[model samples]
Target: MAKERSIPAPMANPETEPFWAAAREGRFLIKRCTACGKAHWYPRACCPHCMSEATEWVESPGRGTIYSLSVMKRAPEVYAVAYVTLEEGPTMMTNIVECDYDSLAIGQAVQIAWRPTAEGGPPYPVFKPR
Candidate 1:
């Protein structure tokens, strides 16, 4: 059965406000360091690679491949969590939704899916098999 997991609202500070704002519009975002030219997962003011403050926000295609996954059958609700390596580069920890948990496999292509916030904040990114 495909069940919906209870998604909590994400809190946003100044550094992550833009990300949350874009999420509300159903867009996925990642940070790219202008100096190092490497994209990073967590949005921050500075680049983790070159320690450069010259970073900019770039919209992700929201496509990725599953690096690893685990199904939490012991939880109150069954769900799958995974490290999805985004097409942009960085791997993000996220949930896999809208599919049979047993059907997921490593290297499977997936696309971003949004789970709306119950607290009326920005939606969160999840992945569904493509």
Candidate 2:
């Protein structure tokens, strides 16, 4: 039996509200440091690269390659988790959805897919084979 995966709602704070907002709007966003011209995941106020406060949100193309992955078949629901390297240069830990877990591979191309929170909060980004 294929059980549905339960997605937990992500908590939002002052630092991450905009990111959740954009996700609700069906857009993917990442933080980029103006000081060092580097993009990063898990958006923050200060640039992780240069330690600069000049950071801004940018819409991502919502496409990436799988850096690594693991499929958990023994869980309550079968699901795949992966580290995806975004075209913008940041690798994010995310769920791989809408595909056969056994067929997933490293370096597989993917695009953004959304799953609504179990509590009806903002939807979070997942990925499907592109």
Using lDDT as the measure, which candidate wins? 2
Model 1 lDDT per residue over 1-130, tens place? 5456777788789999999999989898899999999999889999988999999999998999999999988545889999999988899999999888898999999999998877787899999999
Evaluate all candidate structures by whole-model CA lDDT and list the values in order: 0.91, 0.92
lDDT of 1 at 121: 74
Error of 2 at 95 (Å): 0.7
Give the C-alpha miss distance for residue 90 in model 1, angstroms. Answer: 0.3
Return the TM-score for each candidate structure: 0.94, 0.95
Question: Per-residue CA lDDT of candidate 2, range 1-130, in tens?
Answer: 5676877898899989999999989999999999999999988999988899999999998999999999988656888889999999999999998898889999999999998997889999999999
Please report the TM-score between candidate 2 and the true structure. Answer: 0.95
The runs of at least 3 residues in candidate 1 whose Cα sits more than 4 Å from the true structure, single-residue gaps closed, are: none
The Cα error of candidate 2 at residue 76, in Å, is 4.6
